[model samples]
Target: MGRTDELFFEMIETYQRHAQTARNAKYQETHEMAEILLNMDITAMWCLTQRTPDTRSRLI
Candidate 1:
């Protein structure tokens, strides 16, 4: 598989783990860590697709 594909798959797993962490965490710091992972997920997905919010609507 391509490096991008690998990265994306890893990102997906990380996102899933973080989502679970967020669900279980009760402290503010833990919540912040989970939010950071969520942001990473978004950024990784954007990178895989080469996208930005200001760009024209993507076909995918």
Candidate 2:
């Protein structure tokens, strides 16, 4: 994997961790917002990977 790929995965992990933290803290609104953001990030990542066959292969 390249540096960019590593950074992308790190970002996703961070968002997921933050969402769980918010949920654990009983911040329902924050948790929901975090979840939404996480989904958006994943969607964006998927779309970006789809733009290149090499990236799509690496992802799989």
Candidate 3:
């Protein structure tokens, strides 16, 4: 993989690890909510990129 891809995956892993660590903490309610939302948003964007466009994708 390219360096950029490796870096990207590393960042994702870091976020996931942080999420897990926060989940184990006592005062993590707000942090958990924010982390979950951030994860969801990033996942949604990645899924969107994987979709094959039915129209005018490459031309645009």
Sum up the clashes in candidate 3: 0
Query: Candidate 2: where are CA atoms >4 Å away?
Result: 1-7
lDDT of 2 by residue, 1-60 (tens): 776677668777877786676577566787777778778777877776877677788768
Best candidate, lDDT: 1
Shift in Å, residue 11, candidate 2: 3.9
Model 3, residue 59: distance off in Å is 18
TM-score of each: 0.68, 0.63, 0.44
Cα lDDT of candidate 1 equals 0.75
Q: Residue 14 of model 3: what lDDT?
A: 65
Tens-place lDDT digits, model 3, residues 1-60: 545445446657766766666576566686777577668757754654456352225324
Ranking by lDDT: 1, 2, 3
Could you tell me the lDDT of residue 48 within candidate 3?
43
Q: Write the per-residue lDDT of candidate 1 for residues 1-60, one digit (tens) a residue.
A: 656566667878988999999889999899899989899897877776674432214324
Instruction: Give the range where candidate 3 is weakest over 10 consecutive residues by summed lDDT.
Output: 51-60
